[model samples]
Target: MPMRPPFFALSATLVLLLSIPAQACTLWAAAGPDAGGGTLLSKNRDWAPDHVQILKYERPFGGHVFFGLYAEGNNDPGIKNGINEKGLSIVSASASSIPKKMRAHQPGKRGVIRTILSRYASVDELAADADRVFSGARANFYLVSDRSKVLLAEVGLDGKFSYRVVDKGVQTHTNHYLDPKLAEFNVSIGQSSSTRQARINELLTQSPRPFTTEKFAAISRDRNDGPDNSLWRNGKQHTVASWIVHSPASGPQKLRVVLANPDQPEALHEYTLDEAFWKKN
Candidate 1:
């Protein structure tokens, strides 16, 4: 009896499919008068095992900055992303897997995650370090924004970093990287990616005109729609993994923060801006 190649070929195809990335993460951004807010929603069997903490940092380094919304503790603090003293916000999303052959240019020096936060105080500053910061690291997508600008950084494990300035009048991002210039990593292979993207698009279309904080919050809390259907069915849609809103100030010192347990709905935390908060001078 002779073996057939068909069976082996089918087995190989199945294995390849199974090895591909399979996870769903969604984010929505909206700007308002002196304020902007959004949501971080995700669902995966093995998401990062981390505790979300909100810390208020005081003077010397940067006065009254909130730190560590979602983070993993290791050398230099693995902040998945967070907001800083200047109301500058940063968020990173996982990209496709990097090939093992890629060499690590600077391993054990200082984790790329910590170096970015400690060194760069603004989005522009971080943009300047994008090349060096992303080298020799696994593929990942980052969103950095301040009151005036929003930028996206896409980095590959091979040490390639691509930058995109969001000038679409308004910009939004999800888990998968969104730079056409980067090597096509085929993010569409993931069923969740397409589904979530469609859902986000739908929400964006339905969003009200003259976007306001309340409307933006509504979009973030929207779970009855696509992408959120699974979470809604499981009765966990409202229990937000994390949420953030950035608004401009009316005077010299003006900023606001709204934090809440989406799952609870009623439970919410709020903060107002102060002159001494952003800077002492």
Candidate 2:
């Protein structure tokens, strides 16, 4: 018998990135044959339970019309994660493994994520502007995807960066660096990072094929590591929101968002990337 990739397992690993402590997030993406002939981009936004978050939309002057998760009352340049009209989507997590002292400047110092979401339409375009976009930026690991490709990027506080295209299998990231050069500076504070990373991957490998948003949502709610360190965190830093974006090889993309707080029950919202939806939102 030929080997078949555990489809849902790849998406399950994406939720693991959200379990790390501090104001961190979990991000993962799956594409090609392993992704059930479509692409799945997922994230669990971990932060203080008190911080309010909302879905933000924008039609930047001449750039892509897009929307993403944002802290309420914030007037930031970009969103936590979102997909543009061109079908490009980006999600991120802190590169906590890289110490602060080594940072040439604050991570997201130049608001790179916002710029890319507002202007670029694909990983290839982002790559073409790599020099202009990342030259002086600080830390963060970004996962970019379009209808057919997925790319993982690590931006160091020292102004260094690396990116790899994940053309197959499921790829994931937590609050650590996976790039060899960046990993050398790894000084992760606790086991939360490594443990979550492992747990998510384990879930992905054991899961059945043909991924679905519901399955990924189940992974995001995982409390296998207890409240503090499970994929669905409940310690000082907890999950505020979760997102799952399904981009198929053909057809309009779709999104599902779950907003939550330790003090309240979760609220779910869904959207289809169609002309009417964009016009209405």
Candidate 3:
């Protein structure tokens, strides 16, 4: 009979496997000339196969109107990401590097995404008040963008946050911490996060300058590393949806969405940023 593994080895393996976060997402944004004139924000939302995702149009009282993506059955404060009528867009990925103890003091965990979308009109405005706006929010890395700029904010649960704003080039984030202040807390559980991060960087570097909406969509659908660690995941927990927002310099913005639920056929939806589009959505 084949020899069995030692109990200690098995235990260690189990612990390591358990530490890997189930919610994995890949996020990135491009702005300025490289983006072909405006900004491009993309995300591949991955989660358990059982959770169905949906799109929602919400207009808050005395706030901007927007459309967000959410998991089915969880409405309020459940916005995974969205774009506002003002042309500002935001997307996020889990920052699992921050320990649970650090995330215990979340004060505005609920509806924070919705609140930001409703209130902030541009990358500059959001960056200017990011500290107050994200106070006590749960740990997560958010990529916020508009026609002229892109901002990446790393919000901690203890009311501390850091952000980087860029008018040109690309900014990317995975589940790990990228900010220097938060780097010390980097406890990236599995190779999946790092692998996906590197894959994105590689693809973006090799891609030609002046990226288009089609290029962004192709990147979101990449499966180079395989089912478990590719940009487009297809393992136990897979990419349920992909989002790409293009905010042009002199025209209406466009949103391209692809839903890939395991139980249903993949669907593609597009939207234009305009009064009529907002009203119908």
Candidate 4:
């Protein structure tokens, strides 16, 4: 059995898993010099109970801020994706079983990603800071993007992580490790990740033109054409909510999003990340 940390000392990351009973999720992003034009990111948050909400935050540093939606009590505020005042956006996908190795204690229980969002001003800084929090006990994937680019940092099972500048068009991650360097430690890579990855490829390939926020949302909602590869799952492990997050390359540079609870698709809520992050007097 997995060893459970004491309640008082439980990391926010650990509490998130225990509190929500969340199973899995799918995160997709597109950016970089080669990305269609600007940035388009999306994700399907597959978890239990389906109780989700959007949250905005302000940093004490005066101008720092960010916004995201997650299960009410989740420590990782950016459950689907979030954008900071600097226009850096982040999204994470849960990779299956990885070799576990505990690391030294770190401050703050808001999970490493939330901590990164609160401190870093750009994608470059986010990646560097995340690199410093490698506990090696978890294998997860994170896609961080700015107006001009996106990067993938796969937190591996080796107390280290790997980075890959996402290619043109779209960058995607399901519930498994895609990098070959750490395949030996991938004992529990989920089967759904491959199915979803293939479906995303087909959808992007069939897109008539470069993706805009609308096109990106369409892909995120894709349920797959064939019987074999379905992107949205409603079985034992299912999609609780779906998110389409986009930040305009220019203008206020605010993060825009369309979030839909699987149980209530037509009731999808659309809001700007700025609205969620800024506080009223």
Best by lDDT: 3
Model 1 scores worst on lDDT over the 10 consecutive residues at 38-47
lDDT of 4 by residue, 152-270 (tens): 77765446467766435667777667778756545444456667777777777777665766777667666663322356666655665666656556644434444444455535666
Instruction: List the candidates' TM-scores in order.
Output: 0.65, 0.85, 0.89, 0.74
Q: What does each candidate score in C-alpha RMSD?
A: 7.8, 9.7, 7.1, 7.1
Put down candidate 1 lDDT per residue, 53-133, tens digits, no spaces. Answer: 344442335433444344334222344555655556666554533222221333432334445555667667767766677
lDDT of 2 by residue, 3-95 (tens): 534323335344353344446688878887767766888998887765567787888898888888877643322367878888889888867
TM-score computed on alpha carbons, candidate 1: 0.65
Give the alpha carbon lDDT tens digit for every residue of 7-101 in model 3: 23445444464464557899988999989889999999988777677888998999999998978753213789899989989998877664444
Q: In model 4, what is the error at residue 259, expressed in angstroms?
A: 4.4
Q: Rank by TM-score, descending?
A: 3, 2, 4, 1
Q: Rate the local accuracy (lDDT) of all candidates.
A: 0.46, 0.76, 0.82, 0.59
Clash totals for all candidate models: 8, 3, 0, 2
Off by more than 4 A, model 4? 1-22, 32-36, 58-63, 73-80, 97-110, 128-130, 134-137, 225-229, 254-266, 272-281
**What C-alpha lDDT, on a 0 to 100 scale, does residue 154 get in candidate 3?**
80
Residue 214, candidate 2: alpha-carbon lDDT: 77
Question: Considering lDDT, where higher is better, how would the candidates rank from best to worst?
Answer: 3, 2, 4, 1
Which is superior by lDDT, 1 or 3? 3
Residue-level error in angstroms, candidate 2, position 176: 0.7
The TM-score obtained by model 4 is: 0.74
